[model samples]
Each structure stands twice: as structure tokens, then as C-alpha cells.
Target: MARIQTMRVDRMLSSMGYGSRSEVTRMGKAGIITLDAAEIADAARRIAVTPDLPARMKIDGEALDPLTGVVILLNKPLGMTCSHKDSGVLIYTVLPDRWRRRTPVIATVGRLDKQTSGLILLTDDGDLLHRIISPRSRVRKTYRATLARPLAGNETELFASGELMLDGDAKPLAPAELSVVSETEAIISVTEGRYHQVRRMFAAAGNHVTELHRERLGGLSIPDGMASGQWALLEADNIASIFHMDPAKQT
Candidate 1:
């Protein structure tokens, strides 16, 4: 188990989603919180958290375990908005209540529109989340799109040249890779996340995207057997793979 340095009792509890600082203070004063079976009266008392160690806390008479970071890969289904306050069904609805209730609330690394579906990443680690989503990271995302019309002449070269003009912008998008899968289907790879980029790119090319699905991100592909709306925890190797980093090289 990794050992995190000591932190204030209230901060620790609040970080683990136990409650707000004021609420934790109330619990501490009520003697409902214990450290190593001893009543903790000071909310500012510092304590270490080691996951491998035996239970060190009891809240409201129930033994509590130390919290750990988590990463999840969800196979997003159509019609669910990634936003927390969307008018449609929320992506969080697909995850278990336990994860939603945990501290450092799990958040999607990037967004996919409600009409699009496929691999999406979630994590409680803020650093990892920022690394994956940050444009400077230059992580590549691959998508398979179904178009309303057959790919036209020289469009492949146009996309590869990265000079397609998008609305509301004076500059063209960065170069992207495009491959024709069929008359009306194609695969696109890009490192940037522009709003409706794929759809807009096709529109600029005189084509319409009827469907879009993300197939891969960075070095990780959607694992087989993961059905739509299903989710699974990403292990250490999987996390490392997402960033294409060696475990030993991770900060």
C-alpha cells in the first residue's frame, strides 16, 4: 500500500467524501469519529493513511477504510450526456453509487456528445485527468465515422494536409490523418479536441457524418467484450498504457 503523509483529520475526511469540514467538526465533537479506536476531538489532528494497514477509523460506529485513487474506462452508450448537469441522462448514471459517493469525485477526462458513443475515461486522480485532457499533452484520439455520402476526390489529401476551414475560425485545423474505410465510412485521427471537430471537418469536406464513435485514445484501445454502458476499473498497467509511459518513468 502507498503511504500518504499525514493530513488534518477534517481535510482527510472531506477529501474522502465523508463530509464537509463543518460536518466533520460536528462529528468529531460528537465523538462519532475515532482514530485507532480512540475518540478524536480535534478536527485539525493530523493522521497518516496507509491502505495496507489495518482499519484505523470508525465513523458512526462503522469501521472505515482508507481511500485510494481510482481510474475507470466506460463504454459510453448513446443518449447520455457527459455533463453533470445535462438535461438528458447523465454519464454518472451508468456508474455504481459507491463511486459517485466517494471523495475526489470521479470525472470524465474528456467529453463525448450525447449522440456519440464509445470509449471514455474517468478518474479520481486530478493530475492524470489533466494530463490526458490537456492539449499540450498531444495525446491522440481515433474515431470511426459513418458519413452520409461517399468520400469525394482529393478529400483524403485535403484532410491529410490539414487545411480544412471550420466555421467561426480564421485558421485551419492542425493536420489530421484520414483513411477511407468504405464509400460512406472513414477513420480519422487527431490530437486536438475541437468542439464538433469531426462532424465539422466532414461538413467542410462536403460530407455529412451520420455517426461517430471513438475507438482509441493515446495508446489504449477499447478492450474487447466491453459492452455499451459497461465500465471496468483500469489497472496500473492500463493507466500507464493510456499515457504511453513506462511504470518506472511515471512521476
Candidate 2:
């Protein structure tokens, strides 16, 4: 089990996006915060942060939000841009206002274009974020693409040949798997995240991707019944699933 850490009530609240020290103190004075069934008397009081602490504490009569180091899985919706600075609807707006002010700041593991949607991860754990996106990880990303035209009949062999190079790319792509779902649709999995990679790959193979949605990253897939614009915090098991290898898809 992970070690249970401790921190001052004010620091914890501030870092977790509850509020600043003064605001938290004000909230405590107003009887809006409690720990172990008692009102907090001091913001500076240090308390053990246990896994069950959120349940043991209440803020405004509701359970405290999850502690920091959170990993979130969001089912992204179409027309929502992932970039924070770019114009148009942004996915971050889907989260709480406090989430936008978190100390470490939750960030996307990798980007999905506005036109594409499906399982996407955001995390405050920087190391975990880097490990998942790092080249050495070779974490597989699977996408379901709708093509503008039918397959050319040789894309499977071409993509699997490990010699396919995208336009303006300097290196050959790593081996990829293609499972055709229909004449104009297929499931493609790749170990790399290059610029417009999935679409570019199809284009390079003489096809155009009309639509795209990421279905899986490694062993983790979008939760069933999860609708677009919906998201939830990922538990340890869910996070671990990201690195699990499937015997069937070794890449």
C-alpha cells in the first residue's frame, strides 16, 4: 500500500483547490468544514491524510473532494479543443473551477484533435503523465476511424510492414496493426503519437479519414455507458490497467 501522508488542513485544502488559507479559515468559522465529526478549529492543524479521509471529512455537508495526485479519464466530445490557449470550446471547462486552479495543474496525457473524441486522460501526477506518453513506454493507442473511401486492399500489409512513413516525416513508423471493421471503417492501433498520425497514416496509404475516435490506450478503454463530456477520477486499478499488456496485441 502507498504511504499515508500528512499535511496542514489549510495547505491540503489550498493545494486541493478547496480554497486559500484565509478562505478556508473563514469557511471553518462558518461551520462549513469538519473533520472526524468536529468543526476544524485551526487551519494550521496538521492531520493524517488517509485513503478514507475524504469520507471522514465534510465540506459544506458534502464529502471532501479527492486528494491531489489525481488521474482523470474523460470521454471527450467532438468540437472541444484540447489546447488551453487555442480558441473554441475547451475540454478543461468541463472540470470544476477549482480544478483549473490546482497547484500542480491537471494536464492531458496526450492530445486528441477537436474533430476526434473518446477516452482521454488528465493527471496532476507529472511523472505518471510523462511515463505514459514517453516514447520508451510504447503504450499502444487504438483508434476507430471512418474513412472517406474504401480500403485499397493492401493497407493491412503496408501498415504492418513497419516501413510506412508519413508525409514530412523523417523516420519510418513502427509496426502497426489494422483490423478492418468494414469497407470504409477499421480499427487501427499504433505505438506512436505523431502529428495527426492516424489520419496521416491513412492519407499516406491513399485514403482519407473522415472521422476518428480513440477507443483504447494500452489496456485502458473508455468506461461503458460513459457519455461524451463526462469524466471521473481514475482509481489505482484503472490507472494500473494503462500499462497492462494484452497477449493478443503485443505492440
Candidate 3:
């Protein structure tokens, strides 16, 4: 004999955020839930549950479902916020409408200020996001900064020794690689992520950063061909390389 299964429908709906348990119970009592036009007798009745997309449970004709998750990298353009809320102008607005409709929700793993432009990772993969972002994971991020004034004095040594102070904070920043590629341009690499770190470091060094662009994260370098405001899907090898393991070394 097949084993009988049972659960309160309202409880399941509540768990999924369809409504509060009390509210769902009221909806059922008010003759809202129906399959093929027959009203469900009890909100507590056992019912089979199945996953469906593009279809959802209805409450007085209002449909609802949990957002599905996805991972994406956006070459975030200037003047867009990473947040999901309708923040006037946002990065998601630039994406094709179909991508915006995906479930789970995609978020920019690390953020770039509205005026600071470059590659930004957006994803719903919790484990992968953690691996790429955890401070203990020691993932390195590289940025190309253009300064309003050329760097001079003890800036190079200060950056090399990681002795630059970022203001009221008593402790110094982690060791970082700072090198000048030109008189007015330089590259800064650091593992510790702090609020406005690159710009602040340059400011601390007595050189004001005029423009900031992130060029690399972990082992993945920004593709030379990709331009601002455009994005590409990362391949498996790209994801694997972020952990410092050579993708080619794997069998």
C-alpha cells in the first residue's frame, strides 16, 4: 500500500511567504483555494506539492512565488546602484528584461560606487559568493586607478609596507601591491576589502584618485575586449581559477 502523506496547506504557503498562516487559513475558509473550480474544504487538508515556474499559487487572483536564484557578472556602468530595490537608475535596468525576471535574485557580490566603473560580480550562488568574498578566503582584487596628481614621496613604501592609515581607524591595512604603470596611473592590489579602500589609500598617500576601475578579482582578469556597461557569463574555468588553482591542472 502507498504511504499516505499529509500536511496543512496553509502552513506550507506560510513557509514560502505566500501569506501568514492565519491569513492563508482565512483565504481557505473564504473559499479561495480551488483546483479545477471545486473549493478546497479545509486549509489543513493534505495536498501534493510540486515545483512550477511561470505558474504560481493565487490568492484572490494575485499570484506569488519565491524568487529563483541566478549568478551573473555585469560590467556595471557609471551611475548605477547594485541594489535590487528600484533605486532610480540601477544596474539591473541595463540588463535584458528576461534576465531581470529570473528567480532567487541576483546581487552584485562586491560593489562599485556610482561613479566608479568596472566589472562587478553578481550572483545568487551563496557558496561561490562566499568563496570569492570571504576575508579569510584572502581573495585578491585588483584595481586600476588614475590619480589627479602623480604619486611621490613615501607613497610607494607606505603602500608596500601596508602602513597607510585610513583615518580614525587605529590599525593599519593589510599588505598590498602598489605600482606605478605611468606618472598618473597606477595599479593597487589588496586582499582586505574596506569601504572605499582604494580611493582612501590614494588620499592617504597625498594623491587624489580621479578615476577607479576594478580590473581583476582573484585569478580571473577582466577580459580586454569587454567594455564598460557590457557583461559576459563566466565559464566553469573562470570560476575555478578564483581559488588560486590552475584550471588546466585538474584532470
Candidate 4:
């Protein structure tokens, strides 16, 4: 038979942000932790940490939060900072408070500025987070901008030229796509995640962006009926779609 995987019950709970080692021991003594319907009175005891651990364990009459990798898609709201330690209301506050206490910590895959609102991914999986944010991924991020002025007509060519340079940047941006929805609104898609790139691009074109909202990232788009600050805890398979570009989203 293959070797069995296991971990200290207290360590699992504490790492998941349930509590500290001593606190877990107290929880065990209080009959608050259980495995497979049996009371786990010794938090120090090692238990099998399997794919089914979440279903097998209960804490305070609730199933354990997904232990290993947790991913969530949030419709980031305006005026909210993504940093965990940022003062006042933060994007982290919209998620479970216990999530912030997790060992590896849940962090945004890439930042969206405080004034910008749109699709943002947060995950506890370090590798997955890095993969998404890496420039080599070439994942397309689409932003719909409301402009203060009407179309200049040449913006489409300028962005698609693949030679547009933002101030202070040493390299030209990769080819980007621009779609005009109307005289004062346009959608721009880019593979780069440069700082304030979309707004800067508009400024370079001599237009002011009155509002900016990300519509999609790769294949992930904010689902209908989801309000600002709303989020969906994603399944394992759903994570793959983050790397798959949807051709239909180009429209």
C-alpha cells in the first residue's frame, strides 16, 4: 500500500486560521473538533490530511474551510485598496476575516488601483498567483473606459501599433486591441499589466478617462448579477479557465 499522508490536527486548524496551537487544544477539549463523526479530543494527534479532509472534519459544527489551495474571483469595487494592511475599508474586508489570518495569506493576483473597479483574482496558492501575474503568460485584460471627449479616430491605430510607450517605461507595449463602443466609450485589451496602463494610454491619445472598469481577464469575466465587492470561491477546474482566452470576449 502507498504511504499515508497526515498532519497534526492542531497544526491544520491553526494554519487554516482557526486558532493557535493552544486554542486548538482548548477546542478539542471542548468537543468542538471532530473527525469522521468521532470526537477528536487530542488536537496534538496526527490525522490523515487527504482530499476528503474537509468532508471528514468538523469545527464548531461546520466543515473545515478548504485547507490547501483557495481561489476567489472578486468584482473589485471602487475606493477599496487591495493591500491587507491598508487603512479604512479594504478589499480583504469583503472576504472572510479568517482568510486574512491564513499562513500563506490570500493576496490579489495583481493589483487594481483604488479608483479602478473590475474583475480581480485572489488566491492563497503562491504558484498559481505568480503564474497569472507573470508577463510571460500574455493573458489579456480588457477594460471599458468612459471618456470625457469623443473619439479622436486615430486611437485604434496608435494602440494596435505595438510601439506606444508610456512615460518612464523603457520598452514599447505589446500590441493591444481597441474597440469603440461609442463617441465617448471604448474597450481596450492588453497583455501587459503595467501600472495605470489603460488610463495612461488614453492620456497619450489626448483623452481623459472619466471611468475605468475591467470587463474580463483571460477567460474570466464578472458574472451577471454580481454586485461590487461580491465574490465567488472558485473550484479547482475553474482555475484553468483563467489561462484560456475567450475569443467571444473580444467583442
Candidate 5:
């Protein structure tokens, strides 16, 4: 069985964006919050936030489900900026108003440039985001890139050897995998997320990236049926897959 995780009432409520810690404390004192049908006056009281526990919690007559953290996978479309501030079309605008208003603020795990498109993960769980994007985790990100010129000889070996250097970098990138799909298009997989890494890597190899589309991240692939600008909730199993582990076996 999965172990139960606990958090203080005020911290949980505030993290979910209900209000500030002091405000939640005040609400608790006013008898607006309850745990398992019993009135809870102490904001610091710890309660289970795990699925393994049966904890019925409510605030002001509304039920709360703390165990199920929000995670979403988006089929990001081109011409959208992955930002809250509008430089071009804001990617967050594509999501429903409720998701945007979520407490703790659901954020994109990693950014895709304005012209890039494909799978993007958004989540309210900070730990999951860090695990997926951290270089130390070595999570694989796969991209299908269209090049301005045909891939030249020895480039694939160079990429696989992790010896290609970008401008202003003293060291070569970690080893990557490359496969040719056509003369001008190929699939590339890397474990790092440097700025314009794909484009710069190609440029350093004497080629230029004309178009780039991310196809996969970690063990999650963009669903073929998902249309551009669409999104779907990532269930617990999907979350587990991000770490390349089985949900039942996850600690």
C-alpha cells in the first residue's frame, strides 16, 4: 500500500491557493474548516494528503481532495509563448480559466520556444517538475527536427560521442542519440535542456535547424490523437512513468 503523506491544514489550504497562512488560520478559528467531519480550529494540525488514507476534508461546505495533485500534458501549438506575460500569444491562455486560477499556480515544466511545438507538461507538483527537468535525472527529451541542409558525414557519430561544442561553452554536451529519418529531417534525443540546444547543436555541426518539434519527454509521448492546442489530465500512472517507474512500486 502507498504510504500516507501529511501536511498542516493551513499549509495545505494556502498551497492550494485558498488564501494566506494567517487567513487560513483565521478561517479555521471561525469553524469554517473541518477534517473528517470534525471541526478543526488548529491551522497547524497535520492531516493526511495521500490516497491511502480516508480523510474527508471540507472548507466552507466545499470538499477538498489533496491527494490528487494536478498534472496536465499539452499538445502545444506553434506561435505560442510559454509564459504568463504576453510577448506573443500566451500559452496559458489556451488552458481553461479554472486551471489558470488554481492555487499554487500550475506552471509549465519546461519551456518551448515561440515557434516550437509538441508535448509540454504542466503541473502543480513542484517535486515532479524538478525530477523531470533536472539534468542529474537524465530524463530524455526527443525532438524531430527539419534541417536547412542535409546531415553531413560524421555528424551522427559526433552527436552520439557527446563531443559537439556550442559557442562560449568550454565542455561538450552529454552524449545524445541521433537517427536520420530523411536527408533534411532526423530524430534527436538529448538529456539536457540548454537554451536553443537543438538549433545550436545543429549549427555547430554545420547544419541549421529550420523546424523543431518535441515528440517525447521521459517515458511520456505525445498522443497521436491529441490535436494541437489541446490538453489532457495526466493520471497517477502517467506521473510515475515520468520517472520511468511503475506506480504500484513507487515509494
Candidate 6:
């Protein structure tokens, strides 16, 4: 029931990080915001700051918080949708209940096409999410891709020299590393995460990717024994390593 006085409900909820201003306003006007037994009819209702405002606040009978954040990782499995719809199975539905109850809301840092499977970070910390995902940060991610062709001498050098195209786009990507793991499999590392980047990059090189699995992010990797569809709480040290900083220095 946390509450803050404001001229508009959208403004208040947006400031609290629930979502964009327009989204909150739409919810408010739809009779989603309520107090006691009465629906909050106006999107611009003035009120005093009170914890009770958000306390037990339910949209479609689901409690929500306007000012909290969450950070967690999910080993996304293929064939599952990443959306919030209830029809098809989603990544969040597979998470243990204990990890689902966090303040504000957490969204996948980036995206993995429904066919792709691997470590996906979900967080509500906007700054941290942006820092780790932004191309400007040069955060590298490694992937093991099963391809249709074997990469040899010149192929690896070409990949590392940024000499590949992305579909119709003429711009070459930043330098990436490619190591042939098998006749039809390779490990690739790239810092620029364009849409369908890995799959398209391989396709551009006269190969097709049959499967793409992310193994590392920001120089940190998932530990052994962490099964697919399982998640674990990240430690403070884990966050520090992404920046190459010791936790002690951060404090």
C-alpha cells in the first residue's frame, strides 16, 4: 500500500518504476487502481503518501509494487514463449515460486528468439541492465553454435577481423572470435548483440546455425550443476566481475 501524492496516477506510478507513464495511465483509467472497495476513477487523483496505497493493491487481483527491483537469471529453454500471456508456457512460469515474488518487476535484459536457449538475465535495475547490454559497454557474450559447416583457417581469421555481413546490412560487426569445436560446431564470441546477430552472422559466412546457446556474459559464466530451467541468486562478487572490479573496491 505504498502511496505518494501526485497530480496523476500515471506520473506517480511511472516515478515508482511500474512502467511507462502511458501504461500506468491506461491501467488507472481501466479501473485497475483502487482504494478499499472503490475503484480509483481518475488518473489524476491527489492523495497523501501512504504505504497502504500499494499495499494489497491488485490489478486483476494480482498484487503489484510500484517501487521495487529484482535481478535474477533464468536458463531459458527452447519452445517456450518469453511473453506474459497465459496461453503458451513462458520462461517465468518455470521459475520457482520463491524467485517470482520480487518488488517492481523484472524483464529479460535482452532477448533470445524463442528457438534460442541459454542463460538469460532478468532484472528491474535499468542502469545495470543497460550497462551490461549496451553495445557501447562492449560487454562480450560467448555462444556455442551448432552449424552446418566447419570453420577452418581463413574462416576464423575472417570472423576475428570483422569481415562478415548481416543479411542485407552492409556494415561489418565488431571483431569476434570463432573457434571450430567440431566439423559442424563452433564457439563464437561477439560484443555487439544485434537482433538475431549470431544466427545471421553464421548464415552470412555461408553456414547455417542449427542451434545457438549462450554460455557467458560480461566475462562471467554459469557454474556447473546448474541445470536447465533452474536459477540461482547471484552474489555481490558475481556482479563485480562483470566490471572487472573487486567487490571490496565497490564498497
As a whole number from 0 to 100, the lDDT of residue 32 in candidate 5 is: 88
Tell me the TM-score of each prediction against the true structure: 0.77, 0.94, 0.68, 0.95, 0.74, 0.66
**Rank list by lDDT:** 2, 4, 5, 1, 3, 6
Cα-based lDDT at residue 151, candidate 6: 60
After superposition, the stretches of candidate 4 with alpha carbons farther than 4 Å from their true spots are: 1-4, 249-251
Question: Model 1 segments beyond 4 Å from truth?
Answer: 1-4, 7-14, 18-47, 51-68, 245-251
Clashing pairs in 6: 1-51, 1-52, 1-53, 1-54, 1-55, 2-51, 2-54, 3-50
Comparison by lDDT, 2 against 3, better one: 2
Output the worst ten-in-a-row residue range by lDDT, candidate 6: 242-251
lDDT of each: 0.82, 0.90, 0.72, 0.90, 0.83, 0.71
Any residue pairs clashing in model 5, and if so which? none
Per candidate, the number of residue pairs that clash is 0, 0, 6, 0, 0, 8
The pairs that clash in candidate 4 are none
Highest TM-score model number: 4
Q: For candidate 6, lDDT tens digit of each residue in 1-251?
A: 65555446566656555566777778777887776656776766765545455564565455545334446777778876666664667777775443344334566778777888887887768888888888777877778899766764466887888667777786988888787888888888888889899988777778788999888776567768888788765656776566552222235
Put down candidate 3 lDDT per residue, 85-171, tens digits, no spaces.
856688877765535544344667877888788778877577778777889888878888999997785676888796768997778
lDDT of 5 by residue, 1-251 (tens): 87877889888777666777999999999998987788899999998776543257778877764333678899999999999876878888887654565676789998999889998998888888888898889888889999999889677899988778889888899998888999999989888999999989998899998899998887788877999999888878777777663222248
Cα misplacement distance, residue 152 of candidate 1 (Å) = 1.1
Worst 10 residues of 3 by lDDT: 62-71
Tens-digit lDDT string for candidate 2 (77-157):
999988777899988999998888788888999999999999899998999999999999999999999999999889999
